[model samples]
Target chain A: MRNFFVLAFVALTALALPSVAMAQSAATSAASDGNTSGVITVIQVDSETNLVGFVLSTQNGELVEVSVNDSTSFGLENAAGDRWVSDFGEDPTEALLRITDQRERFAPVTVTVADGVASAVVDREQGDLERNLGFLFAIYIVTWAGFFAYIFIVSRRQSDLAREIKALTSQVG
Target chain B: MAALPKIRLIWLGFTAALMALTLWMVFLWVPTEINQGNIQRALYFHVPVAWTAMVAIVLIAVASVAYLKTRDEKWDRLAVAGAETGVIFAALMLITGMVWAKPVWGVWWTGEAKLTTTLILFFIYVAYLMFRAYFPPGEQRRRLAAIIGLIGAIDTPIIYYGAQLWERAHPSAVVGPYSNNDSSVDGPVGLTLLVATIAFSVLFVYVASERYRLRKQEDEVMALRRAISLQALRVATTSDSTESISSAPAGGA
Candidate 1:
């Protein structure tokens, strides 16, 4: 029964991720007018003019410009699978600050385009991940979990044998 | 009686520290890959566990050979324990590899050379365990298991060289000094992988040793059961003789 549960857990985790990502992508596409997905190749910050945004290298080898403004929304999947969103609400600098704070350079993102300008950049890479820290945690979890589970099974068997030894020794005595 | 609590505690502490340091280095310190991104980080733990599995196979072969030569049950017990531990690590290696593959290779599994060989290796050890179960406790079982173990050891090298020998989807080694592909990993990434390897190797040793001790306990239990049964038979036989003698005079009168 315990083995069944473990197998179930692993199967669910393996099967759930792709669909979760697909659902997120579908939702984003449904809500937005035009969505273009690409890898962020450049970020230009000009404090002098209060302008800050990034450039994305699209799959078709096109370079698209994205600027953060007050109406712009920033969101990424956290390590716990929670959607963390920050709407700068017309403060382009605030939106840029949030992006810098949350994202690594060159991360893949899906940008919502409106009237030839980028509105909201959804991180496609982040959505694919279980969490920012999830992949690393998973590595550790699988390692330690497998180790301990083996130990637990061994210990149970050992206990049974030990009990048998004790009973047989008593009988002999 | 063999495993000292203090020593186990110390090793546990060290393992925990090393594991934490490795995790920190991997997540916070190592640079993310330009292509694979965070998924590449899985390599740090995956490769190490795979290496541990290979090492465990080597140990099993050595122990199996020693058992065949010396006929020491201890060696056979050690071989079984090692294989059990190896199976755990091999499973981890396969699962982690699959998880990493989906995002990077775009597939959950492939019948590529390295992957196929690894799957075969896993089955061989699993078969080792099952082979031990089919026969009763005796020379035949031990010798047969030892021979199978020695034969199974052959696959480890084939799996290791599978990527290089075949034009396969799996990449060549990237973290070790002896790795064929040097450009696959950067300095910090390589160092993190090295540390992760060390940590997993140490954990393997600890787990395998514990398994060996447990197997020994099991053997002791079986021996005690046999001894108790023999003693019971002796007592029953003596009581029957006394009863027969006591009734013989009455029958004669």
Candidate 2:
């Protein structure tokens, strides 16, 4: 029995290893693209100048300073390459200020840099940390609730089984 | 039989202590991730459930194969329990994953290879459970379920490597042989992950064993019921024969 489990483990591990190279290549492609995908570390809007400045932590871990002007368009995109216009208005400074006001710092945003300037800043869905934390809390509650529910079900079934056994024993006696 | 009393208490205490400590480490000991912050803390439990699901399904497949070879009811019981517990864990895994994805990936779900394949795996085990219950307990039921268990096991590797095999929104493995050094999330995060994994793994064992014992008791009850019905039939047959013999005219005449 022990050997059987060991064999199964080894077989499963062996099958999974072949895909490592493929994953490595994909990661390489995704990580090297700092111009487009990165986490927003800081968003600063200069009300006096109507300009925006933000720090982006690229997938490769390099932090880049991005400057945005009124021309930059805001939008959202997902994994399927599907994208849409953002709720934020066209003004880059206003959008940055709104994002700051909403406290959505450290969320991923798609930035299109052209000639060392941010041409587009897209909010990828609800990137607000507080909103995401609600989902996190929901996840935890659902998980623990599901677990306890399962235990309750098993306990109930056990009770039913015990009762049936008792009735059977009595019948036999 | 239920878990031995002494061992059961020890396991309960240990599991509770480990779980409490993991919760402490997750909320207090570990600092919020500089990048993802508090939402990222979900990883401590999410990753461990995923790992336990993988391990449980693997055991189910192996037990199924052993049952096929040996024809032992014990193996069948083990497989059933493993698969049942596996389904619960996989279900939790998918739920937590989707919750995590919404925050990090900016959507509730993605057709990203890893997420999709894991969903597929979850459904397969669920189907396995339904298939087993649909049939009466017998050779046919066991054999069919064993076959499904083996097939379901094949999905484990596919799910594990899906993210690696395709470029998707799902992040690459943080801690494993396949993890790119740059991709791994560690430090306090890593420590919490370790503690959570150990705690969940123990919980899996405890639950699986309880499920196994329940299955065994159920089988025994079923067998006893069958025996009683057969014996009652025999007694009724004997009594009817005696009544007819006694009611007939004297045999000597």
Residue B206, model 2: Cα distance from true site in angstroms: 1.4
List of clashing residue pairs for candidate 1: A70-A89, A70-A90, A70-A91, A71-A90, A79-A131
For candidate 1, report its TM-score.
0.67
Off by over 4 Å in 2: A1-116, B1-3, B158-183, B250-253
What fraction of the reference interface contacts is present in each model, in order? 0.29, 0.34
Computed on alpha carbons, the lDDT of every model, listed in order, comes to 0.68, 0.69
lDDT of 2 by residue, B1-253 (tens): 4567578668857886897688667766666553444666678878899889889878998999999999999999999999999889988888998888665654566555655666788789889999887888898899899999998787667665765566455443221111121235677778889999999999898888878878987997998899799889999999999987987756645
Each prediction's RMSD to truth: 13.6, 11.8
Clashing pairs in 2: A23-B164
